[model samples]
Target: MPCPERHVIILGSTGSIGTQTIDIIERLNQRGYAFSVVGLAAGKNVERLAEQIKRYHPYAVCIGKETEGEILRQRFPKVRVFTGEKGLRELARLDEVDLIVNALVGAIGLPPTLDGLSLGRTVALANKESLVVGGELVTKFLSEYGGAILPIDSEHNAIFQCLRAGRLSEVRRVILTASGGPFLRVHKEELDRVRPEEALCHPNWAMGSRVTIDSATMVNKGFEVIEAHFLFHLPYERISIIIHPDSVIHSFVEYHDGSLLAELASPDMRIPIQYALTYPKRVETGLPRLDLEKISRMEFETLDHEHFPAFATVLKAAKQGGTSPAVINAADEVLVERFLEGGIPFTGIASGLQTILSRWESAEANLKEISSDAGNQDEVILSTLLAADRWARKAARYLSF
Candidate 1:
């Protein structure tokens, strides 16, 4: 009798979480954890991906663009190289992979996620957009397909660990902790004047630009609120967000029995990434442990929805349920990119979502009907969501002016 090595396929293999996952796997292998890299996928970072393939020696590699795939195919002739969205789907459904680490950003992460789960593979999910855009569809698919999703986001991962202390029924409230980004203290007038460089300078965590900008607007936390609602089967009332500038207490879950449980660790992405890979069984990663005494004090502030209007928009979208979240998520994504490109002012991010949402409601009230009428058929639901997403992105771009 011997332990089997877990074969992993990492989507977005060149991004922040994907790179950290690779680092953890290498670290864990040194500590005698049996794991293998069977496949790797990235967007357009062929050079870094090529470096990864040489080091890890995966059997399959896929890129978003066919041109990059051709280059990779020539370089690694012995390895299987795939191209485009179809290739990413093919990579997820590969027969050899046991775990699919979907660290891919944006709504594009949704399809391969559904593919992996349909095949009954463990999905280590770092893509919050998957849940944010298609939470109902994802839950329905999981109910039918019988796979597992381990949260790789620090906040959700912490809440997941905290919820284990008590029965789900006994949980009263789950509090999500935010670092408040870099503008926690900026006055309202100054917010509109903040530049992309200032927004990208997150106070606590290092992440991709899209996510960093989302953090500045508190929309990242808003999406987390929706994510928690679906992941834990908790109502919006039970989910709360607080500004924890220290970034030590990742999240907290309060029980009905007057007990609160929290998960605290250094704001290291690798910790959650490693935990998601080897869940129900912790392994040594050789990272620094949390030093409690060195932490002088922890402060928590109530989220000022007025300051970050994106939070209010997320709350409204989550409550509305049908295609509302998809519209808002798409709008937010476009606006974040526009802000980064200096095409819009900082305040335009929130205003863009509001305008797009209003226009969507006016143009296609039936979209919500379609979403709500789709029932449990995953295909129909997903199609409706995709249509809504496309419409929102187009509308948001128009509203950006």
Candidate 2:
């Protein structure tokens, strides 16, 4: 008997994880896996999107830039091309798509994620901000709508794999390992002097500029902690971060019985992406396998909270429920952009986030009034999150650090 086919849509089809997902799809199709892409969504990468369309022959496509969307519509007359975030949501809600590979960055990924989950489609989530901004809402949707969130982040994916070994109650702690980024050895005082290019040069993983920079400051790990809290249903205290410079052990779960289960790979994003897309079944990826004998040793260090203030800031926001996480995520995105564009120094990222959170805290009374009401409808809650996100971006942009 033939396996049932999965109809997929790559939401951020031009980015790193998106392209790698397409690669996995192509390879799996050749390996007797029943997988097909029915749609693709990209942001202003008409050429790359066109190439993807030509290869996969998806029925629908979307682009962020209206002119680029038009160009695609003209080029691929047979395929439907939707424009902007609306278009992205359109792709997500399509009845034919069985899975949504949400590889988009930032808060833009949140809406499409909600839409897909609401429509009972499993969302392969690579975007951390979706959980960071609205973990409560996303989880609620899962319970009500009967869909699953398969994490595509390597560390979270690792933890997911580890969790399978025992019952939820038997798991004591989940430890996420970080690559320590490119500036792991650099002194804290010298972080401000580091150039954007220097910070972007991650020692272990090749990723988008924003994520790479976040990893340098260990902010990405903090985001992962919050994500772990939501995905695994663990407390913030049980979710911990350790600096593992080797990048080999993606993550681990310590069981109540004093045993630790870990997942190790060769720092490849496709490994976890593949696992998320094709759950309960493992396929031959033809990638390099781990050879522990050749490797001498793996090192683990404590997270230097003092050096990476953004790490502490994210922890603080995650500890404070409601709209605080959304605010911090929005501010971090803006600060990362400013740093990348040479408008702010590397150290300015943490300082700016601290200042924004402080301002919001000072006006907590009014901000709480604007934050999501637990009893409200999902759409209303979503609106409140977006409102908070917008306010934080504006506050972070104009604030001096």
Candidate 3:
């Protein structure tokens, strides 16, 4: 039997992933794919959001800020309006949406994700931070709600596709490939001198400013470590990142008997986005098809911990699991934003996280002891964790250049 038309709710629809998703939807619409747009949102790209609405005609749109929402409402008075972060949540929770694609970046993506999953919508997640900060919450949500959390990130999507080749019991390990960003060639000692422009110039992919900086700092890769841990339910030690200059091989899975499986394709977001969209069925995409002949070389190097300390930071946080990864993520996001604003050097991203980790460790907080909230999970979930985040940001700001 054919699946019914799927209704999509897209958050951050004007951002890189969101815009590419809309592009995919346009192609799918032309090809008779059975899907309708229900909701779409972004952070102040009102003009582009309006263009998306004119094309997809979603029932609602969110701009992630009140002023922008007000302006959009005035521009299109007939469309149902949603304003600010809460409005984003309301849009995510809408009943008509069959699937929600979360494209918002950073920790800000968390609440809408929770709202979407709580409403039992199938979620295609491009926002890896959601899993990084709240992996346990995400797992519990899936267990309780039975909503599928499909990955839209290329690496995780590759792992998702590779896992299909065999059973989980046979799986041994997963290797997430990274292009290593713009600084892969920069000497270890030269990192202290890296400027914002150099860090933002990603060699392989075009992304938002924050993620671009995260990629250069490898904090993005660190977040992906936690993401893979939750998405595949693998141990942190078993989940590894390889610095592959060519991102052709997205990710790989190894079986217990030593058989290896890999997912390879051109570095394209539409492929993974479409995979999550029309899951269990592949579709024709206008993306450049992978050409093996021209790409005659594939190389992999171990992630240089000596150069990128963020890699070790993630491993430490993962080992000290519970709210520690969330804290690390919250701090890194804040610090990365500062670095991008020219308040700090590129190396400050890791230094800042390290400072916060030491500060919290010395403070009256024990992440493992506080996991289940022997006394206040709600407070941990909201206040303590938030305070930890704020405290980390303040420390980073003060210590940073």
Candidate 4:
């Protein structure tokens, strides 16, 4: 049987990585490649999405917000657009989408990722929540159905690349490098003094709001650690984070024989996106090539858990296993949003999470307890997460006074 033309569905297309993926898609199309866009999704960037619709017309498009979807429908009557979680799932599981690029940020990206992989599609996952929230379940599903994940996140992408030449049994450890966000040098005592604008201004890579904040707390890297654990099928101890401010060398994998392989490149999202899109066959993505001469001093340091408590929280949760990590992820998402809203102090993110876990307790850990299917446990935990988030916000807001 002849292979179908390479069709891709890009979720969160209006965001940083999504926009770059579209740029790569346009380049691929211009070169008379078989790849075409099947689905596109964004939050509120209907105007640019309309431009995307006019250029490389997608078969399906989704807007997660209703007002945006309504506006988009009124504007582009010819295009088929969807809204909300159901629509996101439709776009994810579409048979036309040979591969799904999940660039959406936060926990919202979790459902579609689960749906995409569950349906046996190759998931190019940029979203960390899928692994952070549903790691065990996703792992079990992938094991059963045989779906492949092409890590679009640079750190995971690096580990994925390094492991290509070596076996897991021979692997000693996976060292995931981080940019250390904009606050690598900021003292822990001063974290509470940071404003939203300062936090948003990332020193290295340009990205969405939530992730930028996550980077500062080191929660983003922590999420990546849990993700690497599931993606590489290694224990939390085997997955480590190193602060590399240069962001040139993405990650490193050390073999049992003391040999460490590293993947180096400029902090370019297109490289990884293109790699997943073309996989095995390297495609030309009109992006600027990385120059080692231009980047002179690439340094690495140990992550300061004393300063960034969120990293320690995720690692501890990962050690607990089962529903604990999921709870940690969900609570953190809520707390971050609250902090962004001036509801909680910056340091309260870890505090809120710690409170939730302390209440959930170690002996109480179970996947079914946190899942939406289990009667009131889901509602209880979710409500508690939101409540804790609200409490954190209150604490943060009061702290301002």
Q: Give the alpha-carbon lDDT of every model.
A: 0.90, 0.89, 0.83, 0.79
Worst 10-residue stretch by lDDT in candidate 3?
Answer: 364-373
Estimated TM-score for each candidate: 0.96, 0.96, 0.93, 0.88
State the lDDT of candidate 3 residue by residue for 200-221, as single tens digits.
8899898888788888888888
Tell me the lDDT of model 2 at 268.
89
Better model by lDDT, 1 or 3? 1
Quote model 3's TM-score. 0.93
Regions of candidate 4 where Cα sits further than 4 Å from its true position: 1-4, 362-401
lDDT of 2 by residue, 7-83 (tens): 99999999999999998988888887888899999887889999999988999999998888888888999999999
In model 2, residue pairs whose N, Cα or C atoms come closer than 3 Å (at least 3 residues apart or on different chains), thus clashing, are none
Give candidate 2's TM-score.
0.96
How many pairs collide in each candidate, listed in order? 0, 0, 0, 4
